[model samples]
Target: MSEATADVRDAQLAERKRVAAATVDTHRDALIALSHRIHENPELGFEEHQASAWAAEYLQNEGFAVELGVGKLPTAFRAELRTGPAGGPTIAILAEYDALAGLGHACGHNVICTSALGAAVAAARALDGLPARIVCIGTPAEETGGGKIILIENGLFDDVDAAMMVHPGTEHLMVRGALACITLTVRFHGKSAHAAGAPERGVNALDALVTMYNSIGLLRQHVKDDVRIHGIFTKAGDAPNVVPHLTEAVYYVRARSHTYVREVLEKVVACADAGARATGCTMEYRTDRMYRERRNNHAMAALYQQNLESFGEHASQPPTHGGVGSSDIGNVSLVCPTIHPYVAMAPLGTAGHSPEFREAARGEAGDRALVLAAKCMAMTVVDLAADPSRLAAAKAEFAAAQQAEAAE
Candidate 1:
């Protein structure tokens, strides 16, 4: 803690930062090409064959050991870059490339995966003379399926020292806390009959669905602002003249934490039950994978912010009031010290999952942001590789946060 020691450490970091930035510039062409290729293809999660293959091939070309079809997911992959020694600290940078069903790369995952790839490669080439292992994982199906959750359960991250990824968003941020979420499939069953001849002879399931939807609208006023409930009607009736025999809807219930999500979902389901009973129909519901809230590691975020600022791009604070969605990275944060930061790829206030955002994911601004993100993440990895205490501090922060949440 002496002044002389601190000065030496600062000088060492400055040199590493220079090397990191230069290395990212060296690989700019390949990184930009990869990002655009993924954006143009726009494959959905769990079915990203071309995207996954290109990513693995790129890493393989860069001399990293690659493993495809990781964690039993056909499109998932794991690539590694080892330097100086065999058993050094390992830093894993996550990559998400799957696009939305109809919107293509509207969520900017194209920039996400390529930036992670660029970061891993840049960090490996930093010439800091540090012993470390860089891991880039191609995490598929993050849009719907919990790809990272499955990978963690399969022991993919069991040996990782820290995990990080830069998401493409409207603004640069260390991390925006995500809400816990659950997807529900609700079905209403009723008897069918001819509407014109004998409308009263059969129960109308559409009525039940409409009633339940209205009930949810009213229920939203009673819950906390952190709670978000929304859904769409998937089925109502085959024709206007015939009484609908079945109706279906899919709803997503989200809250600040898992407990609150379940608490709100229980009441939401009750509304459906009442609607079905009043309409003489039967209601049934099922849920998909539940996503947990993300926990950001303070020390780790600070390091990333500092590294980003070193590149002259200021990392801004996220909006305080808004409905934040969920991510599979939340599950990884629960098990390890992880960071899901954001690097701005479009103008401020650009809405995610929109056409504007989709274009930005491959435009000039996105390419610039990708290079910046790579430099920042690689510089941060340099800090972790050269200094063991950086990893320990991140882990300690994560452990403390997890413990506090558990105690609550």
Candidate 2:
């Protein structure tokens, strides 16, 4: 409050930063090795058994109470270092280790998980003056399934004062938009028949699927500018001479807000229904949990940007073009004061979810970005720990954001 208190706080923050930097410096090699190991052994969402075990063990060796298989997710883990008893300020360092389906680590989740681990370990060492609980959450299935959504439903972030994580990307970005998404699989069933002899008896399931796909393509133009609709044929007729009894397609509907996504999704599903009705076939559809859009906390994001600037690498505004994708972290940001910023790991134009991005995820640039991200995150943790009021401001912002969403 007073100048003397401000001076004391500044001195404490400086000391914390020095210790935090030193801690990350001491474990640089190990962190990189961990990141590369995870990259090499890529696993899909909800199936990161080895990666989760390795991360939990690393935090365990650091003296954090490790618990694997939390929130009904087999690969999810919660490791914590507590300074005192209950009711202490709790900060969460999120770790995402799941890789893409074909492109291993294309999104650089290995870097994300290790950066969180490094920050947790580094910040835990400098809690002498600032007493708080530092938690490292091993969240799986960010690439496919919504593991963070599952964890949140199970109260994974009940005590979290704030949450933060850094993702490696083509540019250093302070904050970016993540669209709300719905992924679904639609299947059409029909009666099969011999194409050459009795084709008239066939229901033509493949025709139904093709019609639905085309209808979706046409529906995209009618949706809003921010809406995105895409689908791929996962299954079709098996043989040319035999009519298809079953055909399947997977579709993804995305928009900037969950409400808008639902609205667009209704029309998208109607297209499929029309295809089925026209083809005299029955359609069945299934979807996983919906991913909400990110609610970036301005106060916390500003703090993270300041910390990143401390490393001599300035973070710039997010790209104006290049429509944003989706992530499970969006779900977390909706519930907590969170920041999912980015540090550069690849070149200026490397496209994510591609082979080039996958290769660059394990290169020298990724390693350097990993260390810088950890340091920045650790410093930001110190900022929140030394001055709890900042975290309070972040929470205030989060509450207001939630209120605005509720009103909408």
Candidate 3:
């Protein structure tokens, strides 16, 4: 538009950003308390009743209409804030609060969920009287179950124009993506007999499992550089004297693309088949939940980075080839323009999902990162709500990426 109009819009956008940042600062203590509470509790996927309740309650107190148990998920919730009319874009701020099985908050989901909550509230406060909609979605089960995938299936993300969330990591990264992944459970059955006394009468199932493991090791050499096939022996027989009649293993097959990961999974199953045939054992396998590779919206990520760097905290470039994990948020990215940027909470080279990471998530550095992430995200929301063209650009980028994938 005209220069005067452009200047007016820019002034409004800057004011909205300032208000959003101030709102986050106004509730800094409460927001940090919420994060620490969730970190202390450490609920697992789909079982985060307390965490979900706490998040919903916090949003409700801020004048948002809160709904829990959406999509038939007990721990999932949705908190909505409407600024004026209903025709504006519905921006979703996703929250992930599930903890690891034994590690407890090692994945730093407490930071993820709380930052999202803070951003949503602050953005709503800043965008008051503006024609926009802000939604804070509490998506459980990112660590195990595909909670976001299930929400998508239930049409939770059908109307969302865009989504965003921040994750805690060892370094700040604006554009990192995850691998497509699926888990496989394999079982081999045979006859059992005394190993020392009647070894000839027994069909060794353990031997079959060992053979399949070795075959997978060989197959890894032939796969793509980004493909990863890994497994663990779940059932390797009870005792040494007794010939193992049944053996089981769980394998995770991952790749940069969903189709490629499935192809690799089939190869893994073939390896199991060969092992069963060579050892005279019968083999059966099944697949678990699949996670799509993340489609990071570069346009949206760039906006987020601009806001993040405005705080004087720089971000590192993500690896070009590998060094990534899978998440249910990838499924959300497929549904809407999404950004899952990272904020550093620990020293560089620190491994995630470990005791070190878990401690850092609850330490002083983590607290600072949590608040900074909230302000960055809140400012980004201000950017999108203040300028419609920015959101359109992000959606265009996402649409083009989807078209490219479909062509392949």
Q: Largest TM-score belongs to which candidate?
A: 3
State the lDDT of candidate 2 residue by residue for 1-408, as single tens digits: 899989998897888888998999999999999999999999999999999999999999999999999999989999999755555578999999999887789988999999999999998887754578999999989877899999999999998889999999888888899899999889999989999899999998999998888888888778889888887899898999999999999989999999999998888788889889999999999887999998888898898888777778878777775559998889999888999999988888789888888888888888888898998898888888768788889989999888988898
Rank all candidate structures by their TM-score, best first, as comma-separated numbers. 3, 2, 1
TM-score of each: 0.94, 0.96, 0.97
Candidate 2 Cα misplacement greater than 4 A, ranges: none
Scored by lDDT, the top model is 3
Q: How many pairs of residues in model 1 come into backbone collision?
A: 0
| Weakest lDDT window of 10 consecutive positions for candidate 2 | 82-91
Tens digits of lDDT, candidate 3, 1-408: 999999999899889888988998988889889889999998889999999999999999999999999999999999999977767889999999999988999988888888888899999988888889999999989989999999999999998999999999988999886999999999999899999999999999999999999999999889998898888999999899999999999999999999999899988999999889999999999998799999999999999989888888898989886679999888899989999999999899899999999999888877888889999999998888878999999999999999999999
Model 2's alpha-carbon lDDT is 0.89
Name every residue pair that clashes in candidate 3: none
Instruction: Give candidate 3 regions above 4 Å deviation.
Output: none
